[model samples]
Target: MNLPKKAEDAHAALAAAFNTGDVNTVMSMYDVSGFIVPEPGKPVSGAEKFEEAIKGILSIKGKMEIKTVYCLQTGDIAVGRSEWSITDGDEVKVSAKGIEVMIQQNDGSWKILIDHAFGAEASLVA
Candidate 1:
């Protein structure tokens, strides 16, 4: 699969890949040095660790959808926000907002540097 040419494209690609239930295709969106926040506060780095979390979701057999809220690009880096949801038949399985950070590679393809899957959740007051 080809990497995204724009920041918003990354979210679209990810949703499409997730819907396919192909872990390899979904994993290709991330940069080698990237890390993903699978949970609210727990960050997972490296391919092996993040792959497990992705697989868990794919196993749910739900269709994923993403709507880009906004994307700002500066130089070769970009940051985006999106609203996403997963659905099984007529029922919604999961719905959330996320933040994605991406960097454009030498080939001009954007790869995800940080994927905060539930980043938009409200934070607790201290």
Candidate 2:
């Protein structure tokens, strides 16, 4: 599979990978040293942790939908905001907004550097 050249493509690939329940495919879009915050106040780093996080979400057995609302690229770094929804059959199991920071590699492909899936909600928690 080809890496994404744009931020939108990366998110689209992620949704496709999630729907397939392929953790490896999902992780491929991320930088090797990247990290994600799977929940409020919890940051998971490293390839092993990232793999574990993706596996946990895959276990939910739902279809994921991602919509990129905003993206701004500066030099080799891009910041994006997106909304995601996960549905199991007719029921929506999860719906949330997220912010992602992507870095363009030497090959001109983009990879996620920071994935804050909880977005601002994580910061507002008391």
TM-score of each: 0.92, 0.91
Considering only N, C-alpha and C atoms within 3 Å, which residue pairs clash in candidate 1? none
Q: What lDDT score belongs to each candidate, Candidate 1 first?
A: 0.85, 0.84
Model 2: per-residue Cα lDDT at residue 68? 86
Question: Per-residue lDDT for 74 in model 2?
Answer: 92
CA lDDT for candidate 2: 0.84
Task: Please report how far candidate 1 places residue 122 from its true position, in Å.
Answer: 2.1
lDDT (Cα, tens digit) per residue for candidate 1, span 1-126? 878787768889888888778889988888858889876778888889889878877887778999999999999999999888899889998888888999999999988899898898677111
Tens digit per residue, CA lDDT, model 2, 1-126: 577887657788778878878778888888859789887678899999998888887887779998988889999999988889899889998878888999998999988999888785545464
Specify the poorest-scoring 10-residue window by lDDT in model 1. Answer: 117-126
